[model samples]
Target: MFKRLILFILLASCFLGHAQTYQVEKGNSKYNAFAFIEAQKIYLKLVEDGYATTEILSKLGDTYYFNDDLKQAQKWYAKLFAHYENQVTPEYFFRYAQSLKAVNKYEESDVYMVKFNTSKGFDARSKMLEEDSNYLQMIDFQSGRFEIANAKEINSSKADFGPAFYASNNQVVYATARESGSVLRERHTWNNQPFLQLYTADADENGVLGNPKPMSNLINTKYHESTPVFTNDGRTMYFTRNNYDNGVYLQDKTGTNKLKIFRSYKNKGKWSKPEQLPFNSDEYSVAHPTLSPDGKKLYFSSDMPGSIGYDLENEFTRSDIWVVDILADGAFGAPRNLKDINTPGRETFPFISKTNTLYFSSSGHQGLGGLDVFTSSISPSGSMGKVVNIGKPINTTYDDFGFIINDDTQTGYFSSNRPGGAGDDDIYTFLQLEDLREECEVHVVGNVTDHKTGDPIKDATLVLFDMNNNKIDQQITGDNATYTFRLDCDQSYILRVVKEDYTSNEEVITTPTSSGLMRTSLEIEINRIPVADCDDIGPLLDIQHIYFDFDKFNIRTDAGYALLKIKAFMELYPQVSIEIRSHTDSRAPDQYNELLSEKRAQSTRDWLISKGIDASRLTAKGFGERRLLNTCANGVACSSDEHQLNRRSEFIVSGFGEFKDCD
Candidate 1:
């Protein structure tokens, strides 16, 4: 089982001494030792001899469940529910639901999950299922982010997993239970296979691995040693091993040897004697070490104290990913639980990629079934973002874990125990087609400043609009006078910055097509509105001169452009009121010109009112021949351009006492 990395035996009282037969007790001994294969044999023989109990049926279901044989597990679980449904606990309901899901009996799986939820209140796993009832559809929709295949050249018929990149030599180091040339190798009672040992193999440009060989004797032992992670410089290694030291294997008070992480340094072209990390405890297991890309932090899975979902009676119920800061003095800070990433189920085999993505395997989060691979982004300040499933075929209805990747090449390796593998757990190489984090986003970041003073302007609002003029996002500048909007890459956006008493600024920018934290910096500078006295008639808001056809009072298309600016200015300064004054040249009759001027002014006011401006904020007045700018008076011979000046509109500021001060 995948739990072999840090084995835990959760024995029931029936497995202790309550068995009615000697043969059943013998089976119980094997089961207690995690030898599920041997225990299954004895349990199957008893069932064929017409001997079965609730304990025997439950143990049979779990034996297949732990061995990754979900079909058989489902069969036994069905029998358990049929004969002793009321006798089993909620844990069995969860396991049976998972097994049913593995066989694609989703409807039946949901029935047991609901039953499990009814029995177990406030369980995060059940809540996740309830929230994402369409999880299978979601998984199918997000599939095919990776192209994966088994690494056949280095795989054996036994378990081969936990691959780590040895970048210094362009090789990959992994763990395996394959036989060495040694004639007398001890087998682990848990699986009846030789203990896992470290092995290195060369990986080519395409990430194909071959030419496997055992690692140094100092690193490997007759006991278990696996899951090695090398530092960026490849001068140091952190690996998992049983609690063995000073030429002696050690066990805790419970008579069980727990796993511990050991660090080995490379000096003079040889690996130094490994030393156990200070955080490892004999009472709890700590294994599967991974390092941050910068090598300033170490992450590993453990069931130590304070681990989420840690049970004192059965510590194997769950394990969480924990991290510790690698200090400058080569020591470690206190470990912190990744509370955001861990759930009430097992979360193990954490690997941080070059892009600061934390990839791990977990049965806690919503997945297809079993432990599925998941990824979460790490912020610059070391906070965790949303956790996302890497999706199929990188994940399946079986244990898929130990994911590692190279951001530069977009290729990587992971381990899975899905069917069609050459071993119980085989390492597979994959080419990532897309990032496992959220979609391709570009951070649109910039500062808003005063145009004249060149000083940052806080409290400025920036509104983003897409090409279709749809509002996308909005941000307000803080004390730093900076605004950031995360937008899709390779798209054009219009960022409009608006501040009180300042002219609004707009900038159209196109983001780069490349991915991964791309940023477009734009600094917007806005000018303060000029001070104007009451009753002043002028184009003070930088609006263009309004013009119209001869003797026509209708608002023309060209005039609409200037009116739109007036509408925007009115919206910006809600307290300002303006009077639209219209004038005409002396060519028309005096009474006709007065009527035409009034019509023009009324049309302008009506247009603004139609655009959602309050009627009280505007007034229309006809100043026919009274406020002519040029010398185009009555009966005077003048150029048409000179008369055109008179046939224009003036926006008189009637009420703006609030903006009296220029500053």
Candidate 2:
């Protein structure tokens, strides 16, 4: 659902009674009606005729920009900025930057992006650029699963777009500007081509589609029609068409015939005459229809009232994708904007997949170039997730949109004007590599238990924290003593459990570098603290058996007891400073084991702090899985107990006392 800008329409209208040549007036008329391709031809002619004013150059650049011709847009934008640098708007700066990126002029683009941010300090687009200045890094990695090919048999030399699956059968329904056998041979002045019509064709197992034929005369008219979407049950169909009645095109007082969403029901063996949606109006346009997987909601694009971008009277009113409830009686509800995905820029061609993923194309959000396809997860309750670009080959710096996918088959189609396409806008099929499309979720599932009794500790508080010690989530264990938390990926986490009458215990859980969703299971045991006596804090407080798992730094329940004695000694002598040395068995990589050992040392110091010892009184360091006490070094045969002895923690007094190293 691409919305071509008619930015110069308002400027052209202001010259109503003023003297202007016929070519300029004709071009302005087409431009005002969003006929950018035709307007481009007219503007280029005027440029050849020696009428290349600053406004003419800007308009020419916009025509190419809206048409997804980034190279041509960049050429004109460069000339316009060079001559009218002090007079141009910030929007041109942003478009110029995007054009530079499309042509791979990244370093040069950044210079203009900085200028755009400075010009519009508080704009969302500006803020987005500032926050993720290195966003190109995210696009470099491609999902190597897709093998894309043009559906050449189904394509036409004219504009072909908005591909959708037909009901139950292997057939697909799409929109095209090709001539039909019907009597409505009318041409759309917008592009000097036949008005778009809904066409159906069969798609083979290999995704090559057959030549398409137009739908019944009842649905086709002498007006624009496109974006046909069907329900899963194949009972109803929703599509986009211009507002026309009988032989007359319905227009508002402003001479604008707006687009509208229409519904057609299938009865017996035939499709009923389409009916205009109740929420549609002549004052604004509503087009590009898509339905949710359940068919309980309808999503479409509109430039009606309540849009955030520049109003229509000023220039181009950027359209927004909106959804409406399909009531139980098959009636429509009032429309609501999808604010989570919509920006002040144009967002169109929304395709809701079987997995409840809302796919759409946008010009407002930061992207590689013109409308880039993006996906956002929709929860069961209809909550929208963060939007992420589909990236690289699937999305070029051109207008790549109208996405449709089948999660089960992992195959889908989308329309694009990207390089190497069959024509102006061609349909391409893609297959997802099942293994590569893994979920980016982390689940920490664990049970808390009492140390001595080894019984489940119900209702224990569990807190999840990041490496920075910031609390992410907190929950109490269920009656079964199990707790679960869903965490983000590419991050480190710590799980701490606390029970009444027991000391708090913490464990580190690191996510693996491997792809796909992961779950980490832990058995946390919190011990009951015992009252310490001064005699327990002897001069040689040899805390032994402070153990760690292979390549793990988190303190265990048994090891917490050995550290508790050191906590008692610290409380006994407030002036004493202690240094903690942690080690790991030589079973893992040196770099990994060293990091594990350091975390273990820090965990020991944190435990002492939790036990009322000041952090200033203690320091910690790791010995990188090195310095074995016995013969448990690398390549040495040893029992499990011998290896465990090597992964031990040691405490050394550094202040207010004479200390001797222990063997």
TM-score of each: 0.63, 0.62
> How many residue-pair clashes does candidate 1 contain?
0
Off by over 4 Å in 1: 1-20, 182-184, 313-315, 437-663
Which candidate number has the best TM-score?
Answer: 1
lDDT by residue (tens digit), candidate 2, 301-411: 988887665454346678888889999999888898888888777889999988788999987776777788888898887878877677766777788899888787888
Q: Per-residue lDDT tens digits of candidate 1, residues 1-663?
A: 767533434344355334448878898888877788899988998888778888898998888887777778999999999999999877888889888878878768877876887777557877666545446755775688899989999999899999999966389999999996765567887667888999999999899999999999999999999999999889999999999976888887867888999999999889999999999988889999999989999999998889886865442457899999999999999999999999878899999988888999998787878889988999998899877787899988888998999899999899988889897899999998976445675655567777667787878888999989999888776554655566678999888888876778888988878543443434454543564546443446665467767899888898888888888877877778887878898888888999989998998899999999999888888877777887778889998888888888878777673323211
lDDT of each: 0.83, 0.77
Q: Model 2's lDDT to the true fold?
A: 0.77
Q: What is the lDDT of residue 456 in candidate 1?
A: 78
What is candidate 2's CA lDDT for residue 454? 67
Residue 234 accuracy (lDDT) in model 1: 90
Worst 10 residues of 2 by lDDT: 529-538
